[model samples]
Target: MTAPALIRGYEVVIGLETHAQLSTASKIFSGASTRFGAEPNTQACPVDLALPGTLPVINRGAVERAIRFGLAVGAKVAPLSIFARKNYFYPDLPKGYQISQYEIPVVQGGMVHFFVGDQAKTVHLTRAHLEEDAGKSMHEGLETPGCSGIDLNRAGTPLLEIVTEPDMRSAAEAVAYAKTLHGLVVWLGICDGNMQEGSFRCDANVSVRKPGAPYGTRREIKNLNSFRFLQMAIEAEVHWQIEQLEDGGKIQQATVLFDPNANGGRGATRMMRTKEDAHDYRYFPDPDLPPLVISPAWVDSVRAAMPELPGAMAERFVTADGLPEYDATMVTQSLAFARYYEAARDASQAPKLVANWLMGEVSKRLNAEDRDIADAPVAPATLAALIGRVQDGTVSNNAAKQVFDALWTGEGRDVDAIIEAKGLKQMNDTGALEKIVDEVIAANAKSVEEYKSGKDKAFNALVGQVMKASKGKANPAQAGELLKARLA
Candidate 1:
């Protein structure tokens, strides 16, 4: 296991609770629509509003999605799961209680394997339970003075609450785990993974303790919709807790809110309410809803229909494509990226080359523009052609990058056309390249002597001079070879 991340003299302990809203079209227990951005309270029906004589009927689609997630994570799909009423009084919860799985959950005892900057780590999962989302409390843009509005549009939305053990020891590890989980849910097609639309939300429980001591009091940072905010919030909270302890202050267990704009935009956390234990919610099985049962045949069918998981696909890349483990994992980050890589590899017939460009150049551009692989301007076929030219010694790696930039900026589409227009064809004639190498050797007598005197770096310097004399048009390998021959 990786060493725990230390902050000053303390160790940070972080656990995350992620709420992934199911992709079902309707609410979990009602027929009301689950679409986002609807007008307030319009999508809510009588069952969602808990009107008298109204009863909830389980949505089969939601259960199926929960099953899909359980299988994807290699978790146990409980043959029978019970729904409980978690009593809480909140304005947005029209039912006055949330129908959720408490003691018994659908998915249990799984592990999320991911890498935090090349260090492999595994975070154990506590449980994933099926639940219904509460409505939104619109605190802004209200007509009534000094009053807030309640939007019931999101009420009764199906959600899978995934809880993790306190396994993360740093903010970076937590963010990495969250991102991996987000990608997996979207890959499985269970959740939309749209944080901006509230389709996925994270709550971080952060605490700090000295090395080799018992766990410290944890504060839950709620409703973190963005990964950036998640890391920043945990860091801010961790620092605050450590400082409090150093100054003879104790951390109080509570629910906290992270305001990114606070503390001059560096972000800070403040207490929202004291954290409540499970018993405080008064959990009890709902008498109205029957226990959910799944058969072996149903699980087997779902497994057969599921796509090849990301981990398995990554292993295939390593074995079949001759890619390194790290590269394979990176290429399989998302389904679209993996498909793009496979297409490029097949077209170019160079798996390692395609993997390098995809992870290095393509990823660099995508990250800079904050875009997805699906939205990349350079099509897989076009990228394959570029790689082919490089493999055929038509263009050097540097020249190919220039061609890629042109293609990315819409300057040109055809790789060869761009290469010709920019005069980037590599020097292939041995006579001309030999002449350039002789000229470089003659002018750089000092480097030649240094190389003859057994300085390996001087040989590289001579090769560099040869390429410079040829205006970077000479093939680098050929230049090095010619330089070596002349030096000998």
Candidate 2:
């Protein structure tokens, strides 16, 4: 049995908490700029700095964006949601407490279809709430043997914390869900969806348990940005939990971090806190901010403005466009790619054919070059035209391949001119094909005689020689027709 098959006895249980930086121009609570990367104290306001009398003023944009997120997930928008003080003392948090939601959040009760590899698992949401981010701490070992710098540029940024139920099964499933969630947020015009700049971050809760056992003691892994590390970390944690169980060591419910380069090829997790040692965080409603209330009419307007979601678009691709789920998912992974695809299809007027060429040949090249769909030179319509040439036998398959390469960078220039210039137009002239076929047959008399004598391989060999002689531009239908007639 395979290694994957061998891990049958264990099942990985996981949940994810994703923190997305909202696109609002102002901070979540203060009027300071939400733009990233400015001078440390430039974006800082009195409230952000936790000054003597700087009361926090709620940014209406942050609250509205949070409501939009709630609507996007089909969640309930709480008419009265209050920001709370999450007390944690750190250099990054200037205030003794970080302003976040404790019990009552802005939104709750939503579900997102989580896909892993190919399996679709629906993960229910516990809540999605708006909160203000704390500042950053940049450590420099040289300055004071472990000194660090603080940048308040990110402090007080508007962040929507989306928390999900522990409904994930494997690492692949978690990563897939993360990606889907990221794409959805970007599509809604709520967040920029940039992970490297700390705009989007995920905290994963993972555990492993047998089919009949109670829930395993879970570990929370923090600050995972990209999907690759998410998968690696989750899988590593699952295996670690299994090993602990097998060794008769109890699994600890605590926060942990993925070193990423820990144990060996696979990484390891370190304990941040035990379940019993977890902090209460002293959650209470904020005094400076009032409960956010959104009107139903406003919610409806946002709902009307919302674009088609990722899951729905993928379904339409399969049902309406007759694409596979995989193909649909790939094309609709990003809104830009999907938009490009739809535009190209409209321009070309080929649905199924264009989808195939795009998701197949064009997408493959784009991925290999690490380029986005916008970077590709072959417009969707132009690809449809090239495929049409192949369908009409105007150019052989090999010749069409060459034309596709030219089209990829040439951006829909004349297909006929490129084909002629490249000498790739199919040679379907009966007289020309017959001469080449005859020449091949004469040169390979033994093979032709064997073909006539009932050897299938010999017939294929003769055909191959004819194809070679024609430089792979022979119209296969015409070549087969004349070759058989003259041979007989």
Candidate 3:
């Protein structure tokens, strides 16, 4: 990988701080439910509301999840960590000071490896700390335009804030890192990874500097919920920073919001507020909660129960199934997709064929229908059966597509049944196929003479005629072979 084209002689640098809401049933410090979409403040309890006499109690499940993520990333799970009081004032924060990790964090020093196209890249992790989510402030489309309402239902939700070193140079690399991290968390069952519902969110710190120059002043973009938006926002921000510098303007350190609707969908970002430093937060250890201590025995227990990671699984696919690295990576993108691919591969015993159909036709249809592989209309076994027919020369590739369409639309449950009903079964009888080939050769004398004179297109034309005579039931490869034999 070469560096992306310079933006006004400056290189865009990005670091991401992603918040993955833990899939725990209750809040990090309270018994309040962590479910989304509840009425405003309905889920907030006495502790979440920060009422007097209520003290914070850490959720064990949330800690266990953070440990699991640390192990997944090969990060160091600190034997002991402290929670700090991050002093801040906002309507959404029921507690004046948010509880988070500062000096010491639970997980530290890991690297995330991902591929941008065929190029492999790795982003080093700074730290991933445990924290509680703040309540939401709803101001958009309100009856009182100037006033905002607070929804504390999200308050106290468990969150793992994963911070990355400034290793990403372009928007594409940043987005790739974000996506890979998202898939890993979900694959580990620590997060649901639902960007639309705020289960995962990203904050990007972006800056631009001349090559070999010290890091430039950075602006932090907050709460980018989708990968598309993440990429768009970073690009827009980079351009804006470059343009500003060209106009003799200094880049200011601030927190900004990416407005997807701004400039008629050609997204724009606006500074929300000046960026706050760690010192500005007035951090101090929280007195209510004791130090979080994890024993090696407990970490080992969690490790023993961990699932096979995606990278290892992809390598297995490459070595065991004889798939290309790219295909294996695609298959292991998600746990469900990997399982589906393995089932189909095992059933078909044709790794390349299964990979092609799954990545091509199956993925295309799923995207069109907005369905996941788990919810695909055609099951793995069903797909395997279709592939079998194609492999055995029972149907032409075109005819196999027809069978696939029928199976996808529920026209028939069985692959053979669909093939039979649609009369898509190929002409496999050698005598019958040879007779059609001879008829085509005799009927198109001009084409035959052109083919004998070394025109490949003419031979293709004769093969096309043979397929037309067979109503597309002829195996195309077999027909082409027979045509070449006759021409020879």
Candidate 4:
């Protein structure tokens, strides 16, 4: 990646705080159903409601999921961790405080390595702590004027809050890191990675300062639900901060909200409130729940269960398949895509050809139709069959593309059948191809004379004539070789 651009002699610094909702069936401390989209307060249990006699109990499944994430990131899972109550007051927070890991979070230091363009970047991890989600507040469609309602279904949902150090210099790097993280969690099957349903959310901390200067005052952009909005919000925030500093104004630390449809349905951001520090939260160990503990054997078991990671799989693709780095990376972007690529390569024994088709024609069609690789219409075996035909010279590359289109559109099923029906089979008979080449040479006498006079274009024109005479069924490579031999 090129160096991050400077704005008026200032550099942008960014860190991310991401919340991934664990795929547990019930709340972390209570047994209430963790299902989303429930009626208001329907999923909240007595403990979630902070009743007089209810006590919090830790969920084993949630803790196991957190351990899975910690292992995936190469973080140290603390043998013993504590849960503290983060004292805060909000309408949706029934208990006046949230149970979270503060001084001794479960997962300790780690790093996330990702590529922003061709440059590899690493972001250090502060910690990944377990926490419970707060209830949601809805203001739209209220019966009373200027009134809002609360839905506590998400109140006690389990979450793993992954915090990163201020290591990014641009919005692009931050988005790349977020995307990588999203893929990792989804691949691990610990989280659903659904941004639309609030399964995953990002809060970007942005600041700007002179080169080699101390860190600048930062603003937190909260609840960026989409990656596009993440990039845009960080960019807008950076510009806003640079403008403030250039005008000799002090930068303030605060929390802000991005309104993508603000300013008459355009895009802008507004300050929500001043940002809170650790002191403001007044954290203390929770008296209800005991200290969390994990053993080395448990960690080993979790690690053993993980599937092949994306990085390792990509490297294998490069070394074993002789694929370019870009092709390997693209094919391994998701688990399904990687599986599809592997199946095609194994079936066709033409790794490069399969890679090209997947990254080129297959990806193009998928993007145009807005479909995922898992939802692709053409199966891996079907694609491999097409590649095999191209390899064996049963059809030319262009003809193979036509067969592929027919297969993609569900117009035909078998590869050989489609080629036969469309008469796309290449003219591989030596005698027949020689006759066609002789006819083309006789018809293009002037072009042949131009070729003997050392004109390369004339030679190419003669090849095109051969292809045209054969109705585009003759293999271009074979025809070119035959024509050159006859000319000699």
Top-TM-score structure, candidate number: 1
As a whole number from 0 to 100, the lDDT of residue 3 in candidate 3 is 69
Of the two candidates 3 and 4, the one with more favorable lDDT, higher being better, is 3
TM-score of each: 0.97, 0.84, 0.91, 0.86
lDDT of 4 by residue, 293-370 (tens): 899998888889888988789899999999988778778877888999999999999999998999889989987886
Clashing pairs in 2: none
Local distance difference test values of all predictions, in order = 0.92, 0.81, 0.92, 0.91
State which candidate, 2 or 4, has the greater lDDT.
Answer: 4
Which residue pairs come into collision in candidate 1? none
lDDT of 1 by residue, 134-220 (tens): 988888888888899999988899999999999999999999999899989989999989899999999999999999999999999
Among all windows of ten consecutive residues in candidate 2, which has the lowest summed lDDT? 1-10
TM-score ranking, best first: 1, 3, 4, 2
Model 3, position 136, has a per-residue lDDT of 89
Question: Candidate 3, which segments miss by more than 4 Å at Cα?
Answer: 1-10, 140-146, 435-471
lDDT by residue (tens digit), candidate 2, 288-360 = 7777777888788777877888778889878987877877887787898888778766766666667777777
Candidate 4 vs. true structure, TM-score: 0.86
- Stronger candidate by lDDT (1 vs 4): 1
| All candidates in order of lDDT, best leading | 1, 3, 4, 2
Error of 3 at 118 (Å): 2.9
